[model samples]
Target: MGVFTAADEERQRGVRRMKTIATGALALMATVFVLAKWAQSAGAGSWTGYVAAAAEAGMVGALADWFAVTALFRHPMGLPIPHTAIIPTKKDQLGRSLGDFVGENFLSGEVVRSRLSAVGIGSRLGAWLAEPDHAERVTAELATALRGALAVLRDSDVQAVVGEAITRRADAQEIAPGLGTMLEKVVADGGHRRIVDLVCVRAAEWLEVHSDSVMDAVTGGAPGWTPRFVDRKVGERVYRELLRFVTEMRDMPDHPARGAVDRFLSDFAHDLQTGQETRERVERLKREVLGRGEVQDLIASAWNAVRTMIVAAAEDERSELRVRARAALLSLGARMAADGRLQGKVDGWVEGAAVYVVTTYRDEITSLITETVAGWDAEHTSKKIEAHIGRDLQFIRINGTVVGSLAGLAIYTVARFFGV
Candidate 1:
């Protein structure tokens, strides 16, 4: 379909009206010229000669203007006139010229910067975004974009990337030193006492419940020559002492057993930090854990869970993520609107970006114009252009006839007065 709209149709009608008016004027001029010539020959007033000259000149002007206007679009009177049909024949050249003109004038970096700076995009944007409704609208659009991006991503691919990244980072950085430092702090602060207490309590409870099993195991390990009753008594005694020790450790926070356990952990922590062998062992264990099928699956599944959570948050308008985003946007807009420095920075950034695009891509932009015009049918292009501007051109013809007639009359009168 043609690109011409209702506006174009209205313009075309205007052009037709102007054409009729101009043609009628020309016809009137010709009729006047004939009548005036006849009157002059029949010894009518001297003014008749002036009228004849004016009418003749008016006809000439109208015809000349009509030819000039018509030549821009098509051949005059269907004659194969050279340099006629200017638009249709030279459409490509005209397009290139137009493209060059735009490139030189409008697409220049200075022009772009000047225009954009005057527009004050930053101030307008800030005011618009400062509104609560506007902020909310922007937040909704951002959420939609985020959801779309997430949906477009493949879970498998993201999971692989995430897993690989984590693996690489972990492999690159040794966790042993950090872990050792943490352990040292925990031990020094008696943080490990709670865990020690738990173990002691659990041990005491188990010993109390499994006393008979513990005794039977001790009795079974006794010499064969010993009496079963004596072995049983010895086993009972061993179980009693074991239970007592555990109960004391559980009741006393500063028990020797707890102190010994702390010392052992402190030494291990120090070894982990200072010993290369210990660090190597820890690293190897880490690699092993990471290499496990279950761990790998866990890592991969973590991405899916995160993606789902993010998508859900994005979809919900009342979600913290959306609410926070809206709040952030509102705050930023307010700051930008109120703070001249921020506004200046924003304006500068915008102007710089615009200038960059204009300077860097101007050739491409101009080429797009040239290419589009080149692609259009030459005859169709001519008609389309004429439809837009033919009405204005017709005014030129009308003005030509009127002005020419006045000039002719003045000249003829002056000639008669001077006896020329």
Candidate 2:
């Protein structure tokens, strides 16, 4: 049985009071009938016959109406009469019919569209959302949802997915041509000159500081048959030449070495683009780099870092992400509230979505009503329905009694006047 609410109890009480009044009317009619018959038996007056007839008819009408009303909820006097207790016996049938009725009339796409269009929910919602408080509340809710989603996701799984995606994308796409094009552009724009200058400067400074080391290296590599003094003097001479070359390259922008370096880079860029062997070499290098555990770890770590940053931003109310989201929502809401065309578009979208749901799931939507009613206790259902409308039904019995009495009196008066 469904829970009997306080409101239902109040309605039941009202029904009881109306039932008492209707029963009292029936009793009064019976008492009048008896008194009228006794008066007629004592030869009181001709009007006594009319009063008896009226009272008798009133009692008959009251009992007939009462029987009809009672049969709807239960059998009269608990008898096993056919067609009695209509609701209890046919509850399932009634429920199915109710569901079918609702599906056909209420869940139809046309009905849903018409109702939603009339509501103008889009513009109204926009007006409400345009408020600062509403926008802030929505922003908070969105941030909470984002944070919850991030919390639910495992970082390791996300990292794996991100790593695999990047690896797959890298493997699928050829990078040598793109790299060659980028390098060629850099050289043409003289962007490579700064790097050349940096390298030259560094080399010159290193040679100046390591002159003794350079001499020792040259001396060590010389022939052993040569005299030690001769090797040492040759080493010192080689070191000086090396240092002077580096210093000149650093100072002169149009040095032969600098031009040679530029030509080498330009040729390498061309080979990367047009030479199959060069492209293959680059591809092999790319595979080797991607296959390294450290590189993969670095890629996965990047995703982890980004995920942590986003989650943190989502959790913080004062974060730029949240602020921007709130501002965007407020702007959208304001636009929707003020722009009639935007309002119409929003309304159309909402209406279309509602219509789609109702039309697509009409049966499923209606099944809820049928299933809920079927689950309820049939006796409780009957009682509840009676409680809701029983008070009004009692009035039918009272009306029947009064009307029956009037008809009876009129008939009796006509009979007496016509000498029938």
For each candidate in the order shown, give its overall lDDT on alpha carbons.
Answer: 0.92, 0.91
- Misplaced by over 4 Å in model 1 are 1-14, 42-44, 78-82, 199-248
On the 0 to 100 scale, the lDDT of residue 129 in model 2 is 85
Model 2 C-alpha RMSD vs. true structure (Å) is 4.1
Q: Could you give candidate 2's per-residue lDDT for residues 242-281 as a string of tens digits?
A: 8889889889999999899889888989988999999999
User: How many Å off is the CA of 26 in candidate 2?
Assistant: 4.9
Least well predicted 10-residue stretch by lDDT in candidate 2: 299-308
TM-score versus the correct structure, for each prediction: 0.81, 0.78
Candidate 1: RMSD over Cα atoms?
Answer: 4.0
Residue 239 CA displacement from its true place in model 1, Å: 6.9
Q: So what's the TM-score on candidate 1?
A: 0.81
